[model samples]
Target: MNLNESDMKVQEPRLWSSDGWTARVVKNEDDDGWAVAMTPDGASEPALVGPWTMGRDKKNPKPLDQSAFLTLVKTAREFVRRSEQQLHAALHQSIAVTVGTARVTVCLDITPDEDNPSATLSARDEGDDLLAQVRVPPSFKLSRSSAVAWAEGGFVKPR
Candidate 1:
């Protein structure tokens, strides 16, 4: 179905609706350029704020056409999926850290050795050089800030 300017136009800047998310290209508050915001349905605020770059770089953002709208929806949906996956990874799967001169990767891994579960923490250099191995207990803990900092330059001296 084709969506014309009259059909897409709304009285107000849509925050979000239960049906789905909405976004509009407008002048950036920080820059004179344009940007598109992705706000999920019923959301009070935008979830992702990115500069609209897929359209023809003309004076005006190319109208949201059928093909373009479908592409936009697919793109936005994929972004949401990736975001969810990253959140899940941060919560359950694995993490790689970057300390000043070191990188540490930690993860909860379950192998065929079900009789012996393990949490492995492998430290490496920025050039992907293996530094050391630390066998953590099954009850290992991790957080985003801690992981980021540890990856940035946080490490304990091996004694």
Candidate 2:
């Protein structure tokens, strides 16, 4: 069966919903006040969790409202964005170095895996020609000096 966007049912607001995000009020483990957790779809955990305001009785947590839900969506989206940026910075690093008469870009890309972790250090010329590539340990550090040294030393694996 093929399902289109129009055929999809509109998600109802609840303590937990399956739309792009779900806002749920849960008992705070560290304190007596309740906390609201905003979880993005397909994520294992909530992107944002914070203290929730009390309801009229001053006991039960306030119900989720349109205003609060919109704010939570913005906050959760930003959280996901920042997380992706940090992960990208950790995985891919690059440096520019002069190799003889030509300037080359050296990149260190790390592929993390549970069974086996690996990294590739590659150099490319001005026109994007592959100059050299070497399989290195994931923990190998890449710097301008290191890249220049490797290129000058005949592109051998650096110690």
Candidate 3:
């Protein structure tokens, strides 16, 4: 009863766990077909869930094998990695523009909240010195023209 997760991993006909990932074959609630779920260790929900192959009998799901389990782990890992990259891109964005004789990096950081979303627009010089920052609308569009205009206008909060 005091064993750790390594000793409790289960590799059965419909389930497999290894390499910090688990693959489970379950009945698809939406239809008669079976489905496979790939969940990372310590995760509450699966990162990937899709259709599963049927057994020869066509009634049961195909038994999970080493090959299938490895494939599922690879796919699920990729899915999680891409999801993280997308979220980073959405929450933090930056662009470089020429402000007179100096180069400036404009950054937009968005904090998403159900009650009220917020965003901050900031600028940094080529030496990574904070030049100016202002609060902006969450819907503010960050583009080259907007960044140039902001710097040209003395870093004022854009209306």
Candidate 4:
């Protein structure tokens, strides 16, 4: 093999490749360098929105190319969609335990010993408090009702 005959073009792999996740850079709200947002392929919204975890620097954001962006969008979109779906499935099925300004829904999935189910419910505020926990038959019954009830704190505990 020739050591260095002439100028050569080197290719590279996309950023943040996982089993079902991807990430890329986009224009920041400030409209300066770049910020990263994750979107699942089939979803219309971004799954995670934060300073791009896998970018170049604080000021200079990595270039926004099609290859990387597409992958990122697909992965992120799927993540968002699945998360939403899981939450939806937990509606009336999970258990409910309201606490504080936030509503925590604990969704338990597949298990013989309910003491520790397979998965947990989604949706929580800044503070991790138990708002609602769904643990049986999986339904979205507590979506809004629980929040309203918790806010008022007028309803007595259900027997």
Candidate 5:
């Protein structure tokens, strides 16, 4: 049968869509229980997956409802938000170092990509003016001592 746009829309009972999220109930392949997956709009995979409530018969999963779907969307959005915050903190780390009478800030920004992985070490004065920046290997670690050394060495690239 030829399917039109309206006909192609999924009408499965176990799947529900909300503002920008979708809740899907699937059987847990690892066990007899069921699980629900929450995926955000435009995302390929679910951002949150967890055990779901069982139906009265105990064989099938409880059907998705407005309350459950709303809760799942809230939880999945928070999970994605926290994940992004953690990744941002890891990628951009900074520390303050005391050099002479000025306090300088040293920041290590890392860009991780499969094709090209790189890191940059940058130093800024107390007023946040750029002092020196150099590209370093992705594996380079930033520490208080390293920052101090960089500042003491005239903001040169650390060995």
Candidate 6:
């Protein structure tokens, strides 16, 4: 298929799009400054948006260039990665404790649903074999004392 020049990568003064990312300079809503938004291809919203450099006149935004676009891409990718990591950490938690003379690791995994959010509390022995697993409320708090208490209580489903 023939692609027109406009359909190809754009490198305008205020807009740049290439390599699965687009950088657009827009007016800041909170102030007179300019802001740049970095959006990945196929995404409706920008993953990163921050202040942009002002032009020599200090009235207009600085032109978008190759160097600036690349920097924005890198920063935006890192920002997305960090956000994913934080969400993963919040959804899954683990702690290790001793049950009798053997070591065990307890984990809590949360499944977020609009209608029925839920969580699972599971334990694994030192050999990584599943000791027990039970459904729990999403609000259940996992702590060292709680884990130890559960283990000592014979791994029964907590009340």
Model 4 Cα lDDT, one tens digit per residue, 1-159: 663322332222324433344454566777565567664434565578655433555555655566655655565566767987876654324444556554454334443335643433343333755444433332223445654553355433321
lDDT by residue (tens digit), candidate 2, 48-70: 89888888888778777777777
Off by over 4 Å in 5: 1-12
* 65-147 per-residue lDDT for model 6 (tens digits): 99989989999999999999998988899999998897989999999999999999999998999999999999999999989
Count clashes in each candidate, considering only residues at least 3 apart in sequence or on different chains.
8, 0, 0, 26, 0, 0
User: Model-by-model lDDT, in order?
Assistant: 0.55, 0.83, 0.93, 0.48, 0.87, 0.93
**How well does candidate 5 match the true structure in TM-score terms?**
0.88
| Candidate scoring better on lDDT of 2 and 4 | 2
Cα RMSD to native, each candidate?
12.4, 3.2, 2.1, 13.9, 3.6, 2.3
Q: How far off is residue 151 in model 5, in Å?
A: 1.7
- By lDDT, the better pick of 1 and 2 is 2
What is the per-residue lDDT of model 5 for residues 41-87, given as tens digits with 9 covering 90 to 100?
77889999999999999888888888788888889989999999999
- Relative to the true structure, candidate 4 reaches a TM of 0.32
Give TM per candidate: 0.43, 0.81, 0.87, 0.32, 0.88, 0.92
Lowest lDDT sum, 10 consecutive residues, model 1, at 10-19
Top of the candidates by TM-score? 6
TM-score quality measure for candidate 2: 0.81
lDDT of 3 by residue, 40-71 (tens): 88888999999999999999999999988988
Greater lDDT among 4 and 6 belongs to 6
Q: What lDDT score goes with residue 74 in model 4?
A: 66
Which lDDT value does model 3 have at 35?
100
Better of 1 and 6 by lDDT: 6
Q: Which sections of candidate 6 miss by over 4 Å? A: 2-7
Off by more than 4 A, model 3: none
